[model samples]
Target: MQEISYKQKVLKEAKRQGIISCWFFLANFAASFLIAVYKAFTQPHTLKQLQNLELIDSVITNLTTLAATIYIWLAIKKLADIYDTDVYEIFIKAVIAVVLAIFLLLALGLEGITPGAVKAVSYVLVGIGIYFFILWFKLNFALAKITNNKLFKTYVFFAIISAVVGGAIKTLAMFGFFEGGVYMLAAALSIAILYVLPTAFYLYAWTMIKEE
Candidate 1:
């Protein structure tokens, strides 16, 4: 039997780990959804009205955000296992990527270009640009440590894939794909599902592409 290369082994492990992490996220999302629904019923207002309750809304949002962050951290840790790299190092890199992205966005405002262009571009640049940077940083750093491939190239590949998935979701929401009282509930559910789906896909693709 031909011996599999270390890179291949790492890729295979990453894929398996990624898929497992996705399942964890799915479970968390389900739990969060149930909590959201229970809260909706217990509260004295409609869902839209509940959204205006800053304290309650903040609590719910923070829980969801924490779930997402933990999911990413776990995925990175799994990738680090395959790559033989320090998980802390990967995490630190992820943090740096986020900080740099924020600085860049701040710089954009400082440059004082037209207010109109800034208003339009700021959202896209800050929103999508920061997200891609984080994805690229994690994907490339983990992949390079495992595969001896160029980090930038792997980052580019991951960034493109992540961007397309994110853009599609945003486009759907912007077009009023879910509108109405009942539809608002449906929209909230859809948003939660959409959020989970990309993470699921990324995990699956990473497993498939990385040499096992």
Candidate 2:
């Protein structure tokens, strides 16, 4: 039997491991969501109104972290196919990326140096930058393993597009683009859509690249 080409092997492993990684993320999201609901329901009546904000924010952050972890695993799986690297190595790298991203955001948020006028803006920028960096690193590394091209470029392209879309939607919502008490829900849904859309696009791009 003809042996599988290196590219085919990497792609196949990536696909299989990607499925596992996605399932893991789904499980994490579900658990986080349940926890958020529990927290919301059991909280004080006065805090119940605030519960949605806190709980939903927590859920979104946790889901984002879970997704990052899975991407890191996918990257490591790809590397293993190419270099026979141990899974532990991938886990370490992924952890490092996630930790660094979180650290950056926390540091920026707590710095207390920026002026009040720009503090919120700075924090937002730091958070977005950290997230985009981790995502770009993970996706580019995985794509590089599959095809030795400029993976980072494509990753950044899709990432910026996603951010723009997400930001625009949030801005409009904040400016009363949506009426009624459902604005918060609209914002949350926009965030969810933003998070998934880019990943979906990247997956499609990767598939097309692999088929070539």
Candidate 3:
């Protein structure tokens, strides 16, 4: 009975995390769009206003990302405990590494270090992103197995597809295969699909867990 209760708690946490994650993506996208619009229409005399708009966009994205990260960490920790897995340990290490990497980049920027060091940080960030993808894939795979919900496994493929499609569209646009408006529409749709599909699968996985 205790195990069942704990599992239910984790499922609820996972569901809440999924919703927050979706909001993070959507809010960031909206913020970016607004910034772009502001830049396009703002007069040169409004330089301060443009700077403020960008600052607000940055703050919104950062706060939502932080909130999503916290919930994600909590859900992963609880799920790891229930499943007797150490994936959460990897997550903890990755979080630390990311913080250190960011700090190093900021310090280098302030010290006017060579661009090489900045490039190195960019590489580190890419590696950290891959670590996150691996962790996400493994966790969802485990959930798929335990809940017998194959929807959980589909998110990984959707994520890959979105990346590929988005890249292809951007490349084609660069070569004039698409008009500006067409490229923008395609980009927006791809991003929307990317965030929405994985979130839908995550929510469905939680529903399966609830049914179990």
Per-residue accuracy of model 2 over 115-162 as CA lDDT, tens digit each? 763666566667766665675566566455545545435755776777
lDDT of each residue in 8-74, candidate 3, tens digit only? 7776776577656656665666777767655655557477887788788889889977876787687
lDDT of 1 by residue, 129-198 (tens): 6675665566565565564545335445654665566566556767877554565465454655455555
Evaluate residue 209 in candidate 2 and report its C-alpha lDDT on the 0 to 100 scale.
43
- Runs of candidate 1 with Cα error greater than 4 angstroms are 1-13, 42-91, 97-180, 206-211
Candidate 3's TM-score: 0.76
Identify the runs in model 2 with alpha carbons over 4 angstroms from their true place.
Answer: 1-11, 22-71, 74-77, 80-97, 104-145, 148-156, 181-189, 203-212
Error of 1 at 71 (Å): 6.8
Candidates ranked, most accurate by TM-score first = 3, 2, 1
Write the number of the candidate with greater TM-score, choosing between 2 and 3: 3
Worst 10 residues of 1 by lDDT: 147-156
Which one wins by TM-score: 1 or 3?
A: 3
Scored against the true structure, residue 188 in model 1 reaches a CA lDDT of: 59
Error of 3 at 99 (Å): 2.7
The top-ranked prediction according to lDDT is 3
Worst 10 residues of 3 by lDDT: 203-212
Q: What TM-score would each prediction reach against the true structure?
A: 0.45, 0.54, 0.76
